[model samples]
Target: MLGHPWAATELGPLPTWDPAVRAATDLVLASPVPMALTLGDELLLLYNDAYAELIGDKHPAALGRPAAEVFGEVWSMPGVGDVIEHAYRTGEPFLEKEATLPIHRRADVAEQSVFTRGSCAVRDSAGRVVGVLTVAAEITQVTRQLQSLGDFAAALAGTLTLDDVARVALRYALTVFDADRVSFAVDEGGGGWRMVRRVRGELMDEADERLPPLWRRGPADWPAPAVEAARRGGASYVDDGEPLRGIAVDRHDQKVRALAAVPLRAAAVRGGITVGHHDPHSWSAADRALLAASAELIGQAAERARRFETQHGTAQLLQRSMLPEHLPDLPRLRIAARYDPGVDGNAAGGDFYDAFQLPTGELGIVLGDVAGHDVQAAARMGQVRAALRALALNDPRPDQVLAGLDRLVTSLGAEGATHELFVTVVFGVIDADRSQVTLASAGHPAPLVRRCAPDGQARATYVDVPAGAPLGLGSRPVTRTVPFHPGDTLLLFSDGVVERRQQGLDRGLATLAEAVAGAHSGDPRALCAAATAAVPGATEDDVAVLAVEHALRPSRSASMEVPAEPTAPSRVRHWLTGQLTEWQVPETVVGAAVLCTSELTTNALLHAGTAARVEIDLSPERLLVSVADSGTRGTVTRARTDTLSSRGRGLGLIEDLTDAWGTDPTVRGSTVWFEILLPAG
Candidate 1:
């Protein structure tokens, strides 16, 4: 008041002050608590040294200013100005405890302050109110501590994994308590503890060499002061004055000067937490309480995550055991298969696929689904797959295989199987050489056929096949034969591909067909991947898909008849050579083709004593030649021979020159065939 020139201009000099204000000033200066006085209608401000420190940088200039000008930010708060006016008007006292207000203390930002304010009217000689005397104490730190606790509780509620819980607890501890490093350790149940440590918000691995050796110590060892405190289940602090030989060091290679440790407790597990500082410091009760609360939350989350992982692992094992270990390799066809369980990781579903060779030398493909998604469903699927494989080995026809499966399912039901156990399967046999597919559906979706038309454009269309009752109902399945030429593909899938919630089967089928038509690659793997990627939403059920594509190759075949005489071999060789020349087969392959054809033709006519028919097939990679005659010969074994023996050398010579050779018995004749790989152009 004596030094500021504004004090003289803004209000009258100290000698000319009001009697009430002079008396209030004398009382404020004598008090040890914060005190301020505003006198008259202008509400001029006057405060002692204790109150001056509370007002921060505005102290000296605010001494003689009006209350509205000095405390403008806080004047409009809920009860601030009103309480002062009420006290001055009625000569009564007003009090508020822990009242919140936005006070401008520093120049850069306005801080939220909680205060206890008591205001009373200052009276003159006639007992009339002249000014207001207010005393205030700030409690902002206490209010912020309570708020931090609430926020930490809410943040820990939504974490689902152990790692997520650890990260959240460490982050809040560093931010709320203003600590430099946070570490969490959980008991691993065998005298071991798994620890996660973070320094300045970055997680550090146990293998990180930059960390102190104390971090890598075992659970039974408590040489470090922090670990001993956690083991004893109370808060403890370590400083540079304590033992520092085994403790961890900071980035500066100095022992951690200050550290606090707390124990974590939950229903199922026990753990610990440690917080450290770079410089020497003291531990406050508030800091210990916050760390202990965070540790408890982390313990609870770890227990829940452990249970989830156990269930997920069991479900995965069951599903994988029921699926095929490997797919079959077919001769002119490519196959791709995939199976995906339900999105919920704990429940195993019943979708499966199988590709294997049948007794008739044809490819048997099966895609099926049982009507549930549980452990029992998975077990039933395995049984169904085993039965299908056993039945397919005897019968290669699709309808016959399904009929056998229906009988097996009926027998199982009679033997006390559940009525809810039902299966829908699409069984098909692919004859790559004949370019034909025989498919049968047992209450399953029809397979899709993607064909390259004569104009060289690809299009997809679903096979029109009749569906019968599913397996457990004992209905006979109907079979259909579809033409599958080179550059064509066949797709068989479970209902998950074409059956979605709130959508019709026809709509999903159309979507799948469109995706297949737009695919540029005819490779089975590529086509299957593209089709699955085009599905619109999350799959509600398990998915299983099997795709097969017949590759295109430059091929030609010719057949002719030869007389049952000595001239038959010579005439057949000449005819085969001429045909190969006409087909533009290379000269190098024509000679070998004629030689193999002559040897087989001569043997067929002489041994069977009948006229022979010659069939030759030329592909880009190999040549297949077959000679058929009227005989039912069973074995076509090669006879051993020496250089001097000419009678048993025909079969041996043929075997040596051909890549592969076999014989098949027809209704009235036996046909011998050999394959020789053509030379690369």
Candidate 2:
């Protein structure tokens, strides 16, 4: 600048400069700080090498040019222009921290730089303010890194699942690393891998319809750096020379110039996380440290989520395995049971139910709650259920069954060296003739009975069974006989079914009774569902419920499992014809019943795509037949048949032939039934 003509034109020859101008110029040029001297009324810019590098590409030309013309874009920003003007006018020094300047590195590229900048008025020999002298230190990298980490930590704190951790980690990695793509892969415990990747702000995955779209599986060997990191048990870096593989974000052969991969050091899970850049870049010490810290956080979160999932799944499987798989499908009684685990905790709670046939042709029903949530509780429940079934088989009396269970529970508590056992159970015996049910309770909630009167109105009331001291404590339980006749349904359930958090047990019981009364009384499956669903929104403890409906069974009652084949409907028709003829049913009634039942069976097999169970109950006055399938599809509603146009072609025949017909949705699938009036007695 000293020998340049432009510099000489702006401030004269170096030998002719004023004393103060020369001294100020020496001070500005020698300073290590980024200092710029804007001299005279025109405010021509002069700066040291440090300041020249800060202003990129405008150095030599900016040497003898006005500060306003050289930095017009930056000078127009809010903090830059106002602070400089204030110091120039008042001659008072000023300082600003974290001031933002939008700098253009090239014609097509722009960036925001933050700095701690200070400015003071420059004076001539006459002591009059001429221009502003500014000094600044850039702090953009440190500031942005801190801000991004704060946001990343806040986001990670709310994650409770592996998928949540992957989503959050991948999203923030893009910002922290400023990379073109980021990927998170998890080991499938086998030899496979499931990966979720985000490239250029868009997530990439394989076109798989079975998996969720955002997290579709990727090729196992696509991310070579991540796979290598996992294999090496350490972080991996690739500055260049590694070609990209796997599913590309845009085209088949997108290139990557740099990569960083970190292995997840989790105890229960093994995987790796990676970030890739499309342009060549070097990984600095600070960049490697940040990536390792992020990987640590992800590993810890993944371990926590996997532990929870493993415990929860194991507990649920153990509890369900202890309970009955298939209930007794009887001719005189219809039985159904349901069990729902609590919403909180991973331990298995003490709720169980079972229905089995006794040696004397009677049915034994039991529901119990042993007091806690843990493996011990589930084990204790299994003991109680097994003991009760044994006692009922030996005596076939409700009160005697409870007495034997009391002894067994007392012995169990004695065997439990650390904690005493507390159990409440309701044991009932349904007579072989379906005339009545004898119930005995050991400090358990009374069983409920829903009765349909001659007027066809159903009412639900709790059976007045005697309550005694809970098992493990000494007390005698008395038996109460309730008239569980035809069209009357009995419900036995654990306290979880009628005890809610923040609500009284009485209110929950009343709500259950109302739900039972409103449900169809003839279908035990529907009754059990309604009773369990009476209290909404995630029960705090496990729920176990059993429903038994006493159907009017005369001399002729039969059941058959319908196969999913073309011959199923014809076989059902032939079987029904023989059964009705043997029972002395009239030809007209038998013909109509056979035709309607065949159509119902065909619908179940065609639409449900599963095996169907057909049950028939014949009385002197009417014949009732039903077809139930385990599939959830093909449910029929009355509105569907309100008009012939909307009714299914097969169901229209059922509606025309039967005296009364309807459909009841069950816990597993659905049941469609029709009643045919027999000839006059």
Candidate 3:
């Protein structure tokens, strides 16, 4: 600058260099660090060799030029020019830490450089501010690295799944290190690993065979450096030569020049992450350290996700196995059942349902929930369900069944088999013959009965059954019989259906009743589904539902008694035909009914040797004929037809001609009944 031609043309001659300018120049030239002196009103630029190198390609031409013209790209940056002007004007030094300057040092290429800028005002002998002497120490690499790690940490904290961890790790690694490609691999235990790779922000398809294998071998098969680093749970960098061969580099189009692998260690599993670059570059200690830290975070997240999934799966399986595989085919009833686990932990709660046949020909339906949500509660639920099924075989009463279950639960608690476990259950027995349902509640919500009024509008109301303390609380439960008329439905559900976090149980129950009344169909399955749908939000507890609907009853014609003798079949058949004719039963169905009545009466007299009574029922859709006898061994069983034989076709003939036939034991003997559909008019 002292002998440059531009200095003579732009600012005339040098001022024999003033005292302040000369002193600043001497000080800047003597310093080994990057320094620059801007002198006079024009702020002419003078920079040391180190400062010239910091400016990149703008060295020689920038000498002897004005500060604004030389550093024009960053002169207007926030507080840049103002700080320099303040020091020059007020003679008060200023220091700014980590100031950003956007510089175009390379032609057509702009870059942001972070620096610590310190400016001191040079004074004349008279103490007047002369020029600003500024020093800049560039820290762009260190600042950018820290910012990248901060971003990675922020994104890593919100990840909940293994895939989420992989995606976030790859995205941040590429951005932070400015790498061309990044790939993450998780060890699949037994010497196998699954890998996901992304190149320049594009994820490669797993099915693409062109992509090299990620887990064909274990870590021991890799190069010594990578294997040793993994053994020590650290990070290692492999250059673009022999070490690259041990790693998969099947990106045929782009040759990998460098690679760095970091071991991800967690309590459950261990994995590896690798970042690649196309240019052969050395990785600094800070870069390797950042990669290691990111790998550790990912490993921790993967372990948590794995543990949750495993627990959720096991809980779901256990809960499902405890529920009924299918509802029983109860006479004159349609049944539907459902179960849903809580949403908070995705773990199964103690809610369960069961439908089984009692010895008395009644269908027993049970819905219950244990107090807690865990393996122990689920196990206890299974034990209670099994006990209830066994008890129902001997005792068909709802109150008796619940009483036994309560005792069983108390026994379990007393034996240290359970810990403070309380249970709520509603046991019900449906008697289709009597058109009634008896239910017993053990601290459970009352069952709901839905029916259509004469006006064809649906109405839903809860049974006013007396309450009892939950099982394990030692309260005797009372059984209440509700008039389950034809076309009425009985709905039993867990509290999860009507219990919301923000609402009381009463309000939820009211909402459920309203939903049931507004249902589009009266079918049991449809009603149960609608009730579950009516829940306000995500359920905090498991839900179990059981619905039973009694269909319309058939009209009855008076029953006839016949003497138990050789002539009883003919007598019963004559009486049945006459009754059917008076009831306007179709001719085609009447003939079949008479024949079935004769066959059933003859069989009963021959098998039990007792008197028999015949009854007929007619509906707009069908006809029912029942024959009761004072025989203990009388059971309706269809005989297999032998094409060559003719004598064993009585029961076979009846089965072929009728729609359905079954036998139910009476107090004295058994009643064999057969139904035939009436012909359409």
Candidate 4:
């Protein structure tokens, strides 16, 4: 209901009703006491019998016409529309402090006179606001008393902050006439006026800060001449804050005057004030330069701060997307990364760590910190990570591997004209064969390895990866190795973890070592989390961590049988037929394999670059037919991609005919592979 366009205000959970709703509406329209109205996007004037005698107009006939149509510019009052919306927004009855409406009294006289007005919002089911109701009286005497207050109570009701009120006033002020800039400055105490808020002259996403400085705090930071002049001035100053207060106004085209500064106060003391004036002209009290309204200007500043906080919350959410929940399996190692951005409402820094299975089934682990923060840093982090993965797959030798990355970064920076990122990266490839972890750094932190004790306490051991330069700016490739036997855990982190603003790098490393040594659990991921939690949310920068714990080599099952006859395509085909007959397999498998085997075998002989043999491992889970040749070329093109017209069906048939298929290009050659789903017998 709150989301409904017709309903105003934030949605409330329950029904809210005035105990005498209908009766109140009736009494509101009745007599000398009845100063009432109804709104339909515009106001309609009404007068009671006794009041009608004073105005000399028929009541019912005057109902439909607007006060403006009847009275012209004489009835124009700024902020009247907002006064109505405020009533709807707050769901409250309002008596405008001091406001005037010009309306006709006698049909013979044919002229509009002044009167005062009031209103309240109407609401509907679901406790949602629907419209506004009003009771406006013609109080000429009341208007004089209100001369001090200006029907502002109703106009400013829904506003919780001074900035909000100023914005409301400025909007009305701007609508009535075009202005170059509208600003609200607040008085702190003795002699300072802080420029708390301003609506951009015109909203431009790419607003440049290269122009003359816009002051945010007080006169101390203001332009030199203005600072001196404002020091001696009262609570407010118009365009004369600098010039007219101490010099002639002829220096500029904008002659400053009528630049009324209203002294704002809760009781007696001057708070601050809002000052306004036309650029090519002088200002006046009615010129919307009412400085006495500084209280509302202060309110506007608080609103801006609240808005900043909301946007800050949103940016934090966007940053969360960089962290992954699970790391892909790398045969002998378990890995995870924890990115603690540290504090809320803070900028997102460039701290990234990623570990995923490489094409070789090896775990490619990377930790790097690009300089700076926000979306740009995280996005750059992504670019470096993706490039690292691609480079590792092409050719991986720690120093050589990272050197390749340096070339990539250099090219990317040159192409994009990227800023020189003073980054450091540590790259490690955990061998799938449990041989060891090859460690390399482009000047990143040395990875920490800890042996998890039976009691959950881990003894920290830092791996010996050679020192090298960071990437981008410049770096010599460096490499080292760590034998990652089944149980050791490796920890990778960014500077945010242990590096304090004043602390030395060595002390930071030692602190990390202590934290890891104290943590229980063989899970490298858990230890990474424990160390991060120990610091709380006080980090000023970003912390990216990668924890890798190798998996114990699991025993796998294998079966083999020798058949008489040669392992030629014909013999293999016959063997499959014979095996299917024995197993009572269906005819479909019998048929699909006839062409699948013939083309596979023929291709092996014709294009398979080496003498690598053909092996078929059939099981209930799958039927794996692999002709692993020394063939480093060609891919398992899908049937859709195959115009291998006459004989090209080898791959086409595999895709159209098999469930899943792929090729694992290795150091030896590419193994174009495929899988066939086997029917349960």
Candidate number of the best lDDT: 2
**Any runs in candidate 4 off by more than 4 Å, and if so which?**
1-319, 322-325, 329-332, 342-346, 416-419, 452-457, 534-537, 552-681
RMSD of each: 21.3, 11.7, 20.3, 25.4
- Give lDDT tens digits, candidate 4, residues 203-228: 31211111111334554444322233
138-187 in candidate 2: lDDT tens per residue? 88886787788778877777665566687788878977788888888777
Misplaced by over 4 Å in model 2 are: 1-183, 188-228, 234-261, 274-291, 309-312, 343-345, 452-458, 485-487, 520-522, 551-681
In model 1, where do residues sit more than 4 Å from their true spots? Answer: 1-6, 9-64, 70-74, 87-263, 270-283, 329-333, 404-418, 450-458, 485-489, 497-506, 523-529, 551-681
Error of 3 at 416 (Å): 2.6
Per-model TM values vs. the true structure: 0.61, 0.60, 0.58, 0.38
Tens-digit per-residue lDDT, 173-196, candidate 1: 777667677777766567666566
**For residues 1-681, what per-residue lDDT tens digits would candidate 3 score against the true structure?**
567763464345666556766777788988898999877777878889889878878888888788888777578776887788778888888888978887677876778889988999887777777778899988898798788777777777776455567777877787778888777766656654556666773533322222122223344344433344445677778666434554555762146678888888787866777787887878888777777777777777778767765786577557666766656754577676767667643466798888877778878888998877887778888898889899888887888888888888889998976558889899998888888888889999998999989988999999987769998778688988878888888899999899888778888898999999987545565677678767687777877788887877434547888788898888887777887888788788888888878888887777666898887656555676778887544234445543222224666677688866655433356677777766666
State the C-alpha lDDT per candidate.
Answer: 0.73, 0.77, 0.74, 0.54
lDDT of 2: 0.77
